[model samples]
Target: MGAFTQMIMGYVYPGKPLANATFEAYAMMCVDCGLTAISSFKLGLYMKIPPKAMFLSQVIGSFIASACEFATVWLLFSSVENICRPELLPRGSQWTCPYNQVIYNNMMTWGAVGPKRVFYPNGVYSNLFIFFLLGALLPIPVWFLARTLPEKKWIRLINVSTIFIAGASMPPVSAVNYLSWFAVAFFLKFVVYRKYKRWWAKYSYLLSVAIDTGVSLMAFLVTVTLQIHNVNGIDWWGLDVSDHCPLATCPTARGVHAEGCPAF
Candidate 1:
């Protein structure tokens, strides 16, 4: 959340010595999000409202969101048989539990153990530390150019966050996964929003919500079926099946002395 806040603050309001500004922007990030209730009142833009009423509404809304998030997570965890187990949830499995696994891995990597070892000499990804400085320095030029020109819309696209975010995200969502997804999102948001303003205003967010909700419902149904199969000892088409391709993950590590397999 601090990183999210930092990036948003940098994007919205560029500052001198952007690195320091970024670090400072998230001072409020550590604050309990629910404790700060003023922003919630801004939802009613054109009306004068009672603070107590707004606070109540905000609390209720937060409660709903929190409940839904927890329920969804529990629903998946309960229904998915051997979730987060790669052996059960193969490459294209419907219940791979990627999100949960990512949280676990991230906790292991940077939670208890500090990032020093990972970014120090002889570390596997020590080379990535250079990008941290590079990323921090990037906004200076963009900010300078924007200040000079002041009218070029294209200047906004020269965001350092874009480059570094893409670099980091590419490994998880490889070319095959993200190329077409990004292209479609770009076209819809940038092109369609400009060309079909009315349609976009009416349907863009609506469509996104509908699609996401539909997918969630479908996944829930799939999860229920999986749980049922587990209890009944019935077999069906492997809903959690995939290519199982672990490219660059050597067979030697898996007890196979295959030729050209790099043992880590």
Candidate 2:
């Protein structure tokens, strides 16, 4: 919802990168904060935690989190040379900043460059407008199938919304990420639940929390201890690059020459 709103802002007020960035940042922040608050509130309700205490904790946590996030970002941008510039970053560097690169590309495409130039009737990507219609209508068949064939429990898994939502992260998240996530999820949710229902119910959430915390802590430690001091860790083929197909990013439009791509 926040992303859609910010996209509308991009369309309405084009060619304003700063405004776009500000709008997107705040809009996403508000959305994330609200969703997180709601989830925490629900968890608190389940645990029978007092509302007042939860509210107070949320307030304190928000301040500490925002400060830490700001400091981390400041440290990253300050310490890492060519932090968001993929073209300038050395090959095999861990600080490629994939997410930042996606954000910047989006800012240029939908904000600074404006969707009008990219998605106009005669534009290269005008066919993308069909997605609006497809998104709206795709659920109808699924709805009908579920209603007509109530016996098939698996039909409910054919979720168009989830597909689109997952697709939104694809530019920064590759096939390996998705495959690994799906594999882990299937193992935990399906295999674990079926084999050890009691253990799954009691420890699944804790495991998830631990994994999140561990990854975050390790990332922060690596940034401060190794990356800040330019100590390269784990020089290997796997760490060298994520996207093997460099030509996949090239413009498909005729006569559009991008560096390294063959001229059409």
Candidate 3:
């Protein structure tokens, strides 16, 4: 029944199927919300909270979050320039908004056009289906061992979904983001946690949360201020760069392909 609804949505909007796309996203959101709630539920259990109160709190929290998040989406979409304009953003511009593009790409792939058209024989991405099938089948044996043995530590090493999601995320995300994330993650995972166990247990997760919050809040305030003052962007080395940088306009390069960008 839902499949038919999605098809009708695709037809009604021809090249644009955002409604069905949002519907499908809502479905996935519910699933992930449940997954997140399971961890919280376990914490509640450990804390000896009454089940009724815990459930009520979760419901209230989810409702409040949904409202605030939707409002945030409206504000950004209404206020930001070049949000959907990939071409307009010079490299390193904060407005590149890879996260929004990821959703737009997914909607076009899975909502407007169905998976068979996108993943079947001779499709542009037909080769990726093998990984999909592999991901589906890979966890069974690992799950079986974990369930049957219940105490084996080695059975938890297989997490194909996380790997796939991260692999997909990297291409759309800016290189600077990945570089910074890897630097911090490598330090924590390999150096800090491994070599300084006591310090890590005391400060690692809290430090990560603080950094993420601070960076996000700063970016928001900076963007709002720039917009208010009618500023395009700073022309410093950090903000102004070619889309492909380091090679798009190097002194050694030749021809008008660089669009007359002064060789740096």
Q: In model 1, which runs have C-alpha deviations exceeding 4 angstroms?
A: 1-54, 61-79, 90-92, 111-114, 121-124, 149-152, 166-177, 225-245, 250-260
Candidate 3 backbone collisions, by pair: none
Please estimate how well model 1 matches the true structure, expressed as its whole-model Cα lDDT. Answer: 0.60
Cα lDDT tens digits for candidate 2, 1-264: 544655677788989977888888888888888999999999999999999999999999999999999998897788688776667766666687888777888788778877778785435887887888899999999999999999998998899999888877878888888998899899999999999999999999999999899999998798678766667676666665556777887878898898889877
Error of 1 at 83 (Å): 2.3
Candidate 3 Cα outliers beyond 4 Å, as residue runs: 1-20, 42-54, 77-83, 86-93, 122-124, 136-161, 227-264
Candidate 1 lDDT over 1-264, as tens digits, reads 433444344434433234424343346433656445545566444357877787778779879989999997887679666776867554445455555454444433443233444334534555766766887888999999988987897997787787666655533344555777788799889999999989998899778879789989976776576543553233553333332465555543334475666554
Worst 10 residues of 1 by lDDT: 110-119
Q: What are the TM-scores, per candidate, against the unseen true structure?
A: 0.60, 0.89, 0.64
Q: Write the per-residue lDDT of candidate 3 for residues 1-264, one digit (tens) a residue.
A: 233344445545545567767675666677778889998898889789999999999999989999999998798778776665757765455666666676676668656675556555434666765765687787788788888987787668767677656655554665787788889899997899889999999898779879989999987787778743346565666664334455533444333245455643
- Among the numbered candidates, top lDDT falls to 2
TM-score of 1: 0.60
Clash count, one per candidate: 1, 0, 0
Candidate 2, residue 122: CA error in Å?
3.8
